[model samples]
Target: MEPMIWRQAEQALAGLLAARFTKDIIRKAEERMRADVHGTLPRWISAWQRLPQTGSLDLEATRQTSAVVVSNAEPIDLEPLTRLLMEFHPWRKGPFEIFGTRIDTEWRSDWKWNRMAEKLEFRGKKILDVGCGNGYYGWKMLAEGADFVLGCDPFLLYVMQFEVFRKYAPQPHRHFVLPLGDTDLPDRMQCFDLCLSMGVLYHRSGPIDHLQKMHGTLKPGGQLLLETLVIESDQPAVLVPKGRYAKMRNVWFIPSVAMLEIWLERTGFEDIRILDVSTTTEEEQRRTPWMTFESLADFLDPQDPRKTVEGYPAPRRAMLLAVARK
Candidate 1:
């Protein structure tokens, strides 16, 4: 079938990867996607392939933040569409509405967008969003007049979500969510106009490497918007959580804003400016029907909300922008 994932990612990457291991990358990605089917993934893909596309779809990625609304679809049945969407459960970072059916996600990603859009200017910029969940922010970036947005996330479900958006969206070539992580992407030294690493830094054991790689991906004088979890700490100003923070076992390092700035400077990002910092609230991340897992509410200490159930500081995130000094 001409490698479905390649067809999905090719036009978006276009010239970037055409002569540079595109075939090998596709081969590996194909292997990964088709490997050991133990759960709902196979069924999800089958259903997605068989699902009907709506007629004369009207698409909007800007009118509503974290949403690529497909409206004016009298031809598509809302219930069937909703059922198909539910197959890809746990929509984390979007509030997409297909036809009239609303998929309110776990995170009110619009809040994150609002915080970012105020500082971001994407005109004629080819941008990269690492750890981009469902490519929600990429749609917003395009809405802000970006030339193109390439999103990278290893998770297949998010890639599927992007495909869902693509089926309804015209000119989806402008935005793509590739099924690749930080290690997977080839470093095209000094290529992107801007690079964003939001909500991803702390996930890496070697956070400095993540920052350096982000810097490597940016062209000279390119901008980087880095948003990640932070902690209010004392001397060290960085916390290595014992087990879990906000019920996420994957979190490794949560640095104070000062510590993060130092890390950025060490990683060779200049003119670093802290834009925003806010503690994650229940309203921001809670169990929605779309993402049924226990969220921030279930993670925080019941008697004292500021402390996590593990008794560590609650989740707080910071947004910082810098120019790559490379």
Candidate 2:
């Protein structure tokens, strides 16, 4: 059998097995990688393989620009590179600049990052990002001085999308996106300094169990940075969607900030702090050239923007910071 395309990633992961992760953790990660059954795996791998390689590319995440920028001292052809990148279409989570080609993704994720950047500290912290779409936030965290970031999302396309950037990354091993979900993580491993669950809570059928899993992943006193869909309500309340919310079938629960805090408190997290609560606007998440599919605009009701097509409350999100109890 031919060697797997992600053999290098596995090797890089192996280097961390003894120092940072348990053997079981590494085993599960590798197993996930090896057990690829996605129909688009071959095409995504081909697109990733065809990406242009460069030497000593500069990777920068500047305050001046929202896009994760990658530039080479020597110029490269933008046309072919842009075409190659477009193979992994529906780019959902990034606004990246590779060489001179700009990939304007579906969500302006930088806006979400900026909301909480000033309040949080990432220096020297090891982070685990659940539902880390294409590892965009991982790079942003690293730029803010995170020591290491391990991202997991069950979506195979997002994992392959990360591979495209990983190819040209100056330090590829600093961040890795495994094709695993929160449920795949070993219980009570307690290895990371921080755990991030962004845009994932509502999709979970059991939100409290998801929070508890995140709490268990962190070391004693480690932090949990959670960002999820929330409704505007003063009291503890939740919206259990009858069918679909915002055109998403997996969205099971949309809780108010009060209810979210209660979930954290009940899941062994302390010092709960609400960082940011903002209404998700079309400008923040809309269709772009790189991602042409239906977006926030399509999900909202045409006559009443405040409600979804299904007559539920429109999308609102909140960022919360909490410390895992020792």
Q: Tell me the TM-score of each prediction against the true structure.
A: 0.92, 0.93
Instruction: Name model 2 segments beyond 4 Å from true.
Output: 1-22, 34-36, 55-57, 61-64
**lDDT of every model, 2 decimals:** 0.80, 0.84
CA lDDT, candidate 2, residue 85: 88
lDDT of 1 by residue, 1-326 (tens): 12554776665565665446556556556655763733556776776776675532243445444566766535666677778888889898877777667889999998898998888788889998899989888877877778888887888888788777766566546777777888776665567899999999999999998998898888888999999999876444899988877778899999999999999999888999989999999999989999998888999999999999999988889999999885
lDDT of 1 at 290: 94
- How much does each candidate deviate from the true structure in C-alpha RMSD? 2.3, 2.4
Candidate 2 C-alpha lDDT tens digits along 1-326: 12443455566556444434555555566566553656677787777767766733244443347877777788888888888888999899978888878899999999998987888999898889999999988888887788788899988889888877777666545788888889987778687899999999999999999998999889999999999999889999999989989899999989999999999999999999999999999999999999999999999999999999999999999999999999
Candidate 2 backbone collisions, by pair: none
Stretch of 10 with least lDDT, candidate 2? 55-64
Question: Residue 277 CA error for candidate 2 (Å)?
Answer: 0.5
